[model samples]
Target: MPVDFGPPRVDPFEQAIELGAGRVRRLRSVPSGPAAPAPVQVRLPRQRAGNCTTAPVRRRPVRRPGVPSAAVASEVARRVSDRRPAPRLRLTRRGRALVRTVVLVALAIAAIAIAVSSRADDVTPVSSRSMVVTEHDTLWTIAEEASPSRPRSETMAKIRELNHMPDATVHVGQRLLLPAP
Candidate 1:
């Protein structure tokens, strides 16, 4: 027996008549055994409900009058007008002199403190005559060597008076008389 493998016969005349009469056509002969065809798969298009674009529409920027511009000008004026009278810096001549005197005294005290601190490391105390007037010796150096224990301001004053120095300038090779301790 030869096997028959072909598409099942569909009656087009009967399908047309059934469709015209608005009736369903039932399959009369279904293939059996190995000759039966596999079921076909179909894909249908998906149906959308409404509008698909979900992004919001862009709007024009809003403009307000006398608000942003005045805010900037007011901020500038606020910073400009913040001069708080500069603390009324009224110093009389007496007060100015007092401040100058205090500053001078503080400078003198600091110079003395630096001199003492520098000499604190040296164990031996240098006598007044140990300092020699060399070509490169300055009045400040001479004072420092002569009276290392004394404040620099006092030593400088003593050296100035002893050497009869009109100003702070001292020439090289000039022998200066060291004051007594």
Candidate 2:
């Protein structure tokens, strides 16, 4: 049998009925009856583009008696007068070079810090203690209990070095050397 993966075909008549295509809605403008008045025409003075000589119209200040209105109006005027176009963000060649240099320097410093810290961590003296494994005891649990302050992996490695174990296997009641925190 052939299987179709695309959407099922829809009936055109059903789609049209669902979309209300069969319903005809007729709406007419409000009938202009005798109650409506006719519009009148008025002519306005036109100004020429090049030959314009009229002075620009100015708004008169609203004479408010209180200090608040005067202060608000003055502040609005000051803000409008002091308004300026914002500076666009465009980096110069020198700025781009400086950012690149800073990033490279930071990466170099991070690499050096990682190297120095790894060497520093290796130089630390490790203390060991002998502990007997009990029933249901694993190397991870032993490592965690032994060195609670340091990483479990580091403590496990230290325990393995102290006990000379090949893998992370230990027998119950077996004597093993563990690392101290």
lDDT of each: 0.63, 0.71
74, model 2: CA deviation in Å?
Answer: 99
Per-residue accuracy of model 1 over 1-181 as CA lDDT, tens digit each: 9765543344432221122223433433455556555433222222243753444322333457755665578998998999676777889999999999999999999999999988897744433553446777777877778778998779888777766789877776566767777
Error of 1 at 5 (Å): 99
The residue ranges of model 1 lying beyond 4 angstroms of the native Cα positions read 1-132
Give a tens-digit lDDT track for model 2, residues 24-100. Answer: 23323343565533332222234355777776322344565655676688999999999999999888999999999
| Top-TM-score structure, candidate number | 2
**Backbone collision count in every prediction?**
0, 0
TM-score of 2: 0.30
Q: Report the Cα lDDT for candidate 2.
A: 0.71
Model 2, stretches more than 4 Å misplaced? 1-128
Error of 1 at 19 (Å): 99
